[model samples]
Target: MTEPRLRELAVADLAALAALEEAGQVQPWPAERFEAVLVSAQHAVLGLEDATGLIGHAVLARQPFDAELEAILVSPARRGEGLASRLLAAVISRACEWGAERLLLEVRAGNAPAIALYRRAGLEEDGRRRGYYPPLAGARREDALLMSRPLTEG
Candidate 1:
C-alpha cells in the first residue's frame, strides 16, 4: 500500500469522517458532534487520505494535563495497512504538543486489533469498564478496556 497523507481535517472532510464513523462504529457520533469537535478549541482532529479517499482519522480531546483519544477509525477495506498506527501516532504527537502528560483511550473489549495497536504504541491496560458499550442487535453488552500512555519531557 502507498503511504497516506495526513493532515488537519478541513471542513470538506467532515462528511467523509462521518461516513467512516458510521461504517466503523456501532454507536457513531452524529454529524453535528463531529462538526463541533472539529471547531472546538479542545479537540484536535487528524485525517489520513489516500488515492481512494479518507482512509482513517483520530480525534483527541485536550485537558490541562492529559489528552483523551476519543475516537479512532480506519475504513474497513483499509485495515492492515498501518493506517490505524499512523492515526494514533498523529494524535499522540498532537497530545504531546498540547503539553499533555498522558494520553488515554478506551477500546471495546473485543477489538483486538485496536488493543494491539494501542499496545504497540506504548499504551498499557490501566483499567476496564463493565458493560460500557450497548449491545449490537441483541441483549449482550460489551466491556471497554481503558488504556493509557505517559509522555516524557523531550
Candidate 2:
C-alpha cells in the first residue's frame, strides 16, 4: 500500500467517514454527529487514504490551549498495521500547527490495546471519568481513562 495521504475532511466526505467509523467502533457515531463535526469550525477533521482508499481517520476539537481527540479510527480490515499510528501522528502534527499546547482524549477503561497504543504515542495517563461510557448493547457500563500529551517534543 502507498503511504497514506492525510487530507482535511469536507462536508461531502461525511458518509465515507461515517462508514469507516462504524466499522471500527463497537458503538458508532451517528451520521448527524459526523455531519456536525465536518461543519464545525472549532474541530479539525482529517481523512487518511492510501492506494486502497479511506484507511483511517482522526478528529480533534480545539479549545483554549488544548484540544480533545473526538475520535480516531482505522478500518477493521486495516487494523494491526501502522495506519492508526500514522493517523495519530497526523493529529499531533495538526494540533501543533493549530497552536494547541496539549492534546487529550478519553478511551474506554477496558480497552487495553488502545490504552497501550496511546501510551506508545506519548500520551500519559492523566485522569479518569467514572462510568463515563454507557454499556455496549448488552454489556455493563465502563469507565473512561483520560490521556494527554504535549504537542511539543522535549
Candidate 3:
C-alpha cells in the first residue's frame, strides 16, 4: 500500500468524506454540510488518501485567534494505523499557518480512543458540556469534553 498523502480537501471530496464519516462516526454530518464549510472563507477541510481513496479527514472552523476542530475521522477499517495522529498533526500545522493561535475541539466523553488521540497530540481537557451529544439509538446522551492546544508554544 502507498503512504497516504495529506492535502487540502475540495468540494469534490464531500461524498467520500461523508461515507467515511458515516462509517467512523455515530452521527455523521450531511455531505452538503461539508460542502458549505469547504466553500466558506473561514473554514478548512483536510484529507488523507492513499492509492485506494480518502481514508481520513479533518474539518476546522477558524478565526484569527482560534479554531474549532469540528470533526476528524479515519476510516473504521484503518483505525489503529496511526492515521488520526498524522492527520491531526497536519491540521495543527495548517491551523497555525492560517494564523490561528489555538485549536479547540469537543469529543464524546466516552470515546476513549478519540480522547487518547487528542491527549497524545498535546490537547489538554479544558471544559465540559453536559449532555452535549444526543443519545444514539437507545444509548443515553453523552457529555462532551472540550480540549485545546495552543498553536504557538508559550
How many pairs of residues in model 3 come into backbone collision?
A: 0
Residue pairs with colliding backbones in model 3 are none
* Candidate ordering by TM-score (highest first): 3, 2, 1
Model 1 CA deviation exceeding 4 Å by range: none
Candidate 2 residue runs with Cα over 4 Å from true position: none
The 0-to-1 C-alpha lDDT of every candidate, in the order given, reads 0.89, 0.87, 0.90
Which 10-residue window in model 2 sums to the lowest lDDT? 1-10
Q: Ten consecutive residues with minimal summed lDDT in candidate 1? A: 145-154
Candidate 1 structure quality by residue, lDDT tens digits, 19-121: 9899987789999999998998899889998898888888999988999999888888889988888888888889989989999888889888889999999
**What are the per-residue Cα lDDT tens digits for candidate 3 across 1-154?**
8889999998888788888888887788988898899899888898999988999999889876898899899998899999999988888887888888999999999999999999999999999999998998889989999999988863
TM-score of each: 0.93, 0.93, 0.95
Model 3 residue 2 lDDT score: 81
lDDT of 3: 0.90
Number of clashes in model 1? 0
For model 2, the local distance difference test gives: 0.87
